[model samples]
Target: MPFLDRLQHWAALRPDANAVTIGAERLSYAELVDRASVRARELAGESSGGPTVLCRPNGLAFIVDFVAAVARTGTVAVLDPGWPALQRSAVERMLQGAGPSTPPAAAPADLRDGPSDSIFLYGFTSGTTALPKAFTRSRDSWQRAFATSAAWFELGADDRVLAPGPLSASLTLYALAETLSAGAAFHTLERVDVGDALDAVAHAGVTRIVAVPTVLRLLGERGLTSGVDAHALTGIVSAGARLDGATLASVRNWAPGATVFDYYGAAELSFVSARRLRPGEHRTGSPTAVGRPFPGVEVRVLDDAGRASAPGTTGTIFVRSRLVSAGYAWGDDGSAFARTGEWCTVGDRGHLDVAGELHVEGRLADMIVTSGSNVYPQEVEVTLLSGLGGAAAQVVVTGLADARRGTLLVAAVVEESGPDAPAVTRADLRTAAADLAAPKRPRGYYRITELPLTGAGKLSRRLLAAWITEGDPRVHRLD
Candidate 1:
């Protein structure tokens, strides 16, 4: 069944059940369907089924607008609320010029049976240029993803999922859709707030949460301090960034009843791989190893020549799956997403271990060549986070302009601070980083109070590199 096609079934089965909740606002399944049906009619009359731009904040309105737009095979371009007015205007203009590829239905269908290839979303991601790149997703791609992930994550009608991020973020939006499609109650905050998230877990009977590692770390750490009861949570889905050992440990301690499932994926490719960490089970071996291929997804590590790489040999990671998007809507600079036959790649570098576990090194663009040796920052960063123990909360490795080595490998460290956080020094970091090859080790280290993050809450390596180059005051060099 299509993603939104399940809505009527859910509404008929549980009309009075809570479908979506953000803060005090609540919408039952029946109410959601009725409101969206009316809104879809209004939208069909206003415009000739053109693509709609959704730029609102996290609230019931965003959800209603999105459901209404996509229910009739209408394409929606989601824009970040944090984006500047000028950037939003430029994107809106670009979307207007591009327009929809396929004409939408003249009126909303009683039960939408749109073709699988019909585009429903135009998700934007930062690219090589100033304007964010747009990618199109068909209804079938998300429907497949919903089925695969829902079963893997153990999400069902009884699960009350909480996603505290903004609705504009793909992670949270997908969570809402998945929860609604399963006839489960969806909970979220008006904004990203650890206190509110913890409260929901403690009081709102939240059974599952889907968020990035940063938000998970915050909720875990703050919940521990505030004595928030997270016994109701049964699952934690971590994605959008690397889940460091410290954050994983904190989450485990904070929500002992919940199993943590960290997955690796990209916007172009939905879900590539995932691993479920049961309670009291620690992730062993290489920290870079994400997990095996997701159900119905094929993973391959290809070298520059497009040949498959041997086990443990780092190469470009490629995926062949029904969950992949319909390529970029516009701004195809040829540097980011590309395809070879049935396989697609975002230039992510990784390898499959002997046990078939995938270990992601980093993106091809983020690879640092220093002193004639190639270094993936993710490898060095992982080593630092694990090696330093509780001394480092986060680490970002980047290359700086060098006169001799072409580019100097360096790292910015966010020291773990608190009564329980262990003390660390430059010497300690250097000693910890000895696990890495001499060339892969960072030549210098800087202390940062906070890790620079993008609007989507993932670590921004580009912004961090700029900070080092521009000598940002927040980043201080360590001896």
Candidate 2:
């Protein structure tokens, strides 16, 4: 079925039901359909093809703009509307090109490769893989994501879902569409302060929330977790990056009644695997394990030969699902990464445990080579946090330059609670990692006040590495 069909069906099926609520603004299914249709009509009148840069912030406008674009069969680039003006201006230049009078096409004319039979609203990966390729997301692909992923999260019509993160981020965009598919009310947050997010959720009477782990850390660090009285929340999902054991434990403790679903999925692949905290399960765990995939999804670990590896054998993870993205658009032709008829994976490295649960080690592209051994940043980050520093609020691990060793591992961390205000010395952390694999030990350490996060609140390793090398003037420095 097409994307608009889902929205139209929901609106017609339950017109009186509350469809959206955004900071004193509310809309029922009927109102949302009417408004969104008008938006669709407006966008359809404008242009030829490609994507419309969804320039609005993370609120009712973002949702309305997205729906309008989709209904018009025009692609949309969901960007962090809160990006620094310089960065945003750069994006505007890149996307919009020149002045409106002689404006370059929204997308390259040749960028359109898929069959013109049915065009769509695909998002571009921002400098993520191979210079930010575009994913040609068909209407069927994204709609199935809403249909199937709903069962994985167990969303229902009565649920009030909140995507507090920016609408420009893929996760929030998917959550927005999926919530509507399940016939649930979606609440939009214009601002993302920890206090404001908590209050917004409470005010909206939100039952489910999808956010990155960084937001949880900020909420925990700011002490807003203690003040929030959002008893209505049933589930809180933390994704994008691994959540430290202590950080995960604290969030669970803060919202004792709510179930926490920590997931790991790549943008190229839809929902890879998720672990929802059950009643008796431990809250604090090694972040490596992201648990099992949803029912319809299939995961395989392939060696360098692209052949399936034995259980517990670490290799690249390839996912198969109808909901997964189609091949990315490149110069002239599109390239499919490890894909079959209905599945595709974004080069994540992992292995399945004896229990058949998936444990994502790291991104294959992010693997660090030091001396003779290859290092996975996720493993090192977990190691540094668990052994050396002992539960830092946030940690980003990557490879650093070295003339002698070729390349060395480096870790940047932030402490949530410590008398030093920044505890966990670099020497201590390195010594800890060295105990496990000294050859691949981190040579540099830095304490940052506020870690840079992507639009979806995930830690940006690119920015983290740049900060360590350039010596972030804003953060306290320690070499």
Candidate 3:
């Protein structure tokens, strides 16, 4: 059941099949196998054989390097592509926890994080405050996670998978797995350009695409993904965050023939719940209806009593699956989260449907209690995106301290216009958020040309929290 074994198998079966594509570089199955084997041999005696770091730029070399490390060392640590040089240098220093054996052979460090963080994949996940909760995924956990996602997506040999999102993000790992496991062709924009992705699909005759909601938003904004011209594609598997109805409409319109499936998962939990939306059906950005337990996955929704909740009642989501994490690279955080029988969750809150669909509400930690009402920040943000002037694709809602309620919501947005552009205003945001409670409306607006995004390309709410907490002059982009 080893993951990379599939690549070796597929390469043997279909050595001539197109395995991966970058802008000017294409690697067939045989070529990929040959190259990765060579790269792995180059690292045979350099490190602990536990983890190697991947800090290279995106392209043929980066992908080959990561796969090679995973094949030989059984672990790969991925660094952010967008990390500033100084911060990257600091982070690299922190992640150098892996040490080579005595009489180390010649090799540059596989990937550098720093001295104490030899994790295969370690990054910070968003929380309510300015700090990102440290999260790590092991090689074993990632293989299981990718398998779970591939099963839900129903990957096949005929599928041509496109990861329009950042190739570095584990989300794109879904496509990489299919490339090897099922011998599907993997295509992605090396630089994450919008039209380039769509054109890649068309150019490659791609059938299936895996994209996060943000990339889908870009396609909508640029008219590249509307349904009117939907032809070569079969459908898209959406993850990372919930996809709302308005955005789904644009996705469907852009690729009319494609079925846009919604998946509810976190990097920790892997791919837990999913459902394929029929053409006539609607997806309202609710994470809840993500379908029932995946194959071999047992799910439970526990109320405060620790008892299973009614089908429609929301509670913390717990999953027992082959794909669950073995543990973190650092701490014992999974004790309360994972019990006997391999059950664990990333602290998502949602309820089970009568048909057994799993709908995610929000993270339990991000739930805001204002006037004793349990308010989900994501719900309020979705409402604002649908109703408010902040419908721009780059807005992210986060929680901050409030004198009255202890915690309040804040909005951070990106504009094509400069940060001083008058398109977004705190009052306009308030008016658009009127459907939500006064306590839930974002109290401030901060504008940046781009959201402080992680190397994985997820919005860095921790960074946004800092901006909101500082009450920086840039927070008043109201003008």
Candidate 4:
């Protein structure tokens, strides 16, 4: 069944059931569909055949308007609420002066279905250094993903889920749609507040959580100190970034009964691999492992010659699944995607272990070549995070231009506490990184008060590199 059709079916079957709740405003399944139908009809009347720009904040208004546009085949273009002024203005202009306006009514009982491959959403990539690239998604593409992820994660009608990030993010948006498709209640915050998120989970007894690692880390930190019974949560699914060992431990401690899921994928490719982290278990697989490939998803590590690489051999990661986006809608930066028949690769570098588990090396573009050896930053970053223990709040490993080694390995450390935090010296790092090869160790370290984060909430090494090189006043030289 189509994604929206599944939602409509749930509304009729469970009219009084809660569909979505934001702040104090709770909408039943029936009411949400009714409002969305009315808005969709309004949108249909004002249709100029251009994409509908949804730039509203996280709230009922955004949800209803978004559904309404989708129902009418209005070609929804979801923009980040925090977009810079220039990008917002340009996108709005491309929308041909048409905008979503509030209006009142309900969807027809019998709505006709359109071609499944019709462009439904212009999902933008969460790029921080440049304008977000707009990618296209068909109803069928995402619908297949919804079914696959729901079945893989054991999501069902009984799951009361909360996705605490802005719905603009693909991870959060998928969570919202997946919850609705499963006939479950979806909870979101108008703004991301740790206290409010905790209260919602405690008050409504949220059974599952879908958020990025940063949000999950904050929730876990607050949950542990607040003495809240987050044990009601049965699952915590984290994506959009790698989950460090420390954050994983903290999550397990806070939600003793919950299974923590950390996945590594991209916006263009919905889900690739994920593993369940249980209490008392620290290791899921290899340090760089992202777990086994998701059900119905095929993953291969291909070398330069387009042949599958041997196990434990790093190469460009390729994914084949219905979840792959229908390519970019507009900004087609030639290097972003490549195709080999039905299989597609987004330039992520990784390898498969002997157990067939995927180990994310890092992005191909982010790989640093130093002294005739290539280094994947994720490997170095993981080792440093584990070695620094709780003393390092966050650490980014990048390669700087060098006069001799081609590139110099540098680790930018953000200590947990401020400047008074215990210093993590080169000797400490060496001991912590004892398991890794010697060449991967950081040649120098910089202690910074804060780390820049991308729009998707992951640490932004690109921005950090620029800041350090340009002598951005915020970065302190500790080495």
Which stretch of 10 consecutive residues in model 1 shows the poorest summed lDDT? 100-109
Please provide TM-scores, in order, for all candidate models, with all chains considered together: 0.93, 0.86, 0.79, 0.89
Candidate 4 lDDT over 1-479, as tens digits, reads 14678888888899999999998998998898788777777776776656778897899998887777776344688899788888887776765633223222234653323358777777876654466677877788887887788877879998899998888878888888889889999999988788999999889879999888877887888898898789789999989887777678778889988888878888888788888867556684567888889888899999989888999998999999888888875667656776678898888998998889898878866788889887888888887887777788777887778899988888888777546778776677667667778788778778777667665566677778788889998777664
Give me the displacement of residue 162 in model 3, in angstroms: 1.4
Which ranges of candidate 4 are over 4 A from the true structure?
93-107, 110-113, 278-284, 368-374, 389-393, 399-409, 416-422, 430-443, 466-474
Q: Which ten residues in a row have the lowest lDDT in candidate 3?
A: 108-117
Q: Which candidate is the best by lDDT?
A: 1
lDDT of 3 at 100: 32
The sequence of per-residue lDDT tens digits that candidate 2 reaches over residues 1-479 is 14455566777788889888877788887787777666656665674444666767766777776766655335666655555567655554555521111113223111112322343544556553333455656666766677677777778999998777777778777777788777899886776667777777656687887888778766544544357765566788887777667666666666666778877776777777877885346754446888788667888888889788898899888888776665565421323355655546677788988788898888766778888788878787777777754546766776667887777667777776656554667676766676557655777777777777666677777777666678777455456
> Mind sharing the TM-score for model 2?
0.86
lDDT, residue 185, candidate 2: 90
Off by over 4 Å in 2: 1-3, 72-74, 80-119, 128-131, 220-226, 283-286, 331-336, 340-343, 371-373, 389-391, 401-408, 418-422, 477-479
lDDT of each: 0.85, 0.68, 0.65, 0.79
Checking candidate 4 for backbone clashes, the offending pairs are none
Model 3 stretches with alpha carbons more than 4 Å out: 48-50, 84-151, 225-229, 279-288, 334-341, 368-374, 385-395, 401-406, 411-438, 445-455, 463-479
Candidate 1 vs candidate 2: the lDDT winner is 1
Where is model 2 poorest over a 10-residue stretch in terms of lDDT? Answer: 97-106
lDDT of model 3 at residue 474? 50
How far is 77's C-alpha from truth in model 3 (Å)? 2.0
